[model samples]
Target: MIAIKGVSTITVAGLFAEVGDLSNYRDPRQIIKLAGLNLQMNQSGYFKGQTTITKRGRRRLRSLLYQVARPLSIHNEGFKELHHYYKNRANNPLTGKQSYVALSRKLIKIFFVIGTRNCSFDETRMLRDIPQLKPLQEVA
Candidate 1:
C-alpha cells in the first residue's frame, strides 16, 4: 500500500512485493524513527537548545540500522562521499542528528530499492543517484 503511493516505479514496487514482509516492520517511517532517525527536542528553563532526537525509538532497530550506516560510510564510495559532504559543511554544521537524518533518508530510499528492485545494495549506484552531494573541498 505505502509502496504504491511512494515515488518508486512499478518495477521497483513489483520487486518489493516479491520480497514480502521484512520482519514485522509494517511502517517504514516508524522503522526509521525507531532507528533514532527522527527529529527531537530539548528545553531548559530559559534557554532552549536545538531540537534533538530522544533516542527513545527502538533500541535494537536503531542500532542495527546505524551499524549499517557506519560501515557503508566507510566502504561505500557514495556513503563516504555523503559523510565527507556532511562533515565539511562550514556555515551550517551537521550535528550527529543531522548526519543520521541524511543517512536515514538515504536508507529509506535504499530499503525501497532493495525491497522492490530485487537488487542488492550498491554503493556506487547510490552515489550516482545522489550527485548533489559534493565532496568537502575545505574545512572551516
Candidate 2:
C-alpha cells in the first residue's frame, strides 16, 4: 500500500486543524458538508434554479480544497482520469469548475478515510468507485 501521493502536507494539516477529529464525522459526505462542498438545490415550487455549493462552513478549508483540486486533477493520475470523465461523461457532464468542486468533495472523502481509518490510499479502489471510469481504465 502506498502513501497517498500528490496531496500536500500543508493542505492535510490545515484540513485536520479545521475539522478536528475525523471521528466526529459519520462519513465522508458529512465532511463534504463541513467544507460546504455539498451540492445545494434552488427550488421554489416548480421553478428550479441553478444548483451550487452552500459555502456555509470554514472558508479557508473550502478554499484549500478548491486550490488543491486543479493540481490534483493534473498531476494525480486517478484524479486526472476522474476529472476527464466528469467533464466528458454522457449524462449531464460537468463544466470545468463544477468538476473541480466535485473533485474537492472527493478529496474530502479521501481525507476522511485516511484520518479515520488509517489506511493507505488505493488508486484502483478510487477508480472503482465510479463506474464511468472503469472502461477508461481498460483503454488506458
Candidate 3:
C-alpha cells in the first residue's frame, strides 16, 4: 500500500491504505461492479420487473464506502452538494441503495485523485471539477 502523506482524515487514509494499489484495478467500472453497483434485471417475456444490484462482490468494501459517505454528506460541503445533486437532479431519483452506489463510485474517484497527487481532500476543488454539483450558499 502506498502511503499518502498529508491526508487530513486518518480514517479515510486508512481505508485507502487497505485499498492497496488502485492502479492495479485500471477500470473504475470494474470496481463499481465489484462493489455490487451494477444493476441486474429479472424479466419474463413481456413482463420485466425492476432492476437491482447483483450483490455478488466485495460486500466489505461497499459497506465501508457507504459508512464513509454518511458523515461526509453531513460535514463535507462537496459531498452535501453531491448528495443533493444525485437526489434532486437524477431522472430517476436514487433510493438509498442507488445513492450508496453513486457515492461509492465518487469515493473511488476521489481516492484515486488523492493517491495520485499525494494531497488532502479539497472540497472546493472537487466542486469545481464536478460542475454538475453546485455548492450551496450559506444562509446569513
Q: Estimate the Cα RMSD of every predicted model relative to the unseen true structure.
A: 8.9, 1.8, 4.5
Best by TM-score: 2
Which is better, 1 or 2, measured by TM-score?
A: 2
Candidate 2 clashes: the total is: 0
Candidate 2 accuracy as lDDT = 0.85
Total backbone collisions for each predicted model: 5, 0, 0
The best candidate by lDDT is 2
lDDT of 3 by residue, 27-60 (tens): 6666677777677897899989998777777777
**Candidate 2 lDDT score at position 89:** 90
RMSD of 3: 4.5
Q: Candidate 1's residue-wise lDDT over 18-131, tens digit each?
A: 334555555566556655667766777987888776676566555545555666566656666777777676757686646756775577667745654567665555665544
Better of 1 and 3 by TM-score: 3
Flag regions of model 3 displaced more than 4 Å.
1-18, 117-120, 128-140
**Ranked by TM-score, top first:** 2, 3, 1
- Reference-based TM-score of each model: 0.59, 0.92, 0.70
> lDDT tens digits, residues 1-140, model 2?
12566777787788888889888889898878888888889899999999999998889889988998998899888899899999999999999999999999988888878778888787889999888777877887
Could you tell me how far off, in angstroms, the CA of residue 80 lies in candidate 1 after the best superposition?
0.5
- Indicate the residue-level lDDT of 90 in model 3: 47
Poorly placed runs, candidate 1 (over 4 Å): 1-27, 44-47, 95-101, 117-140
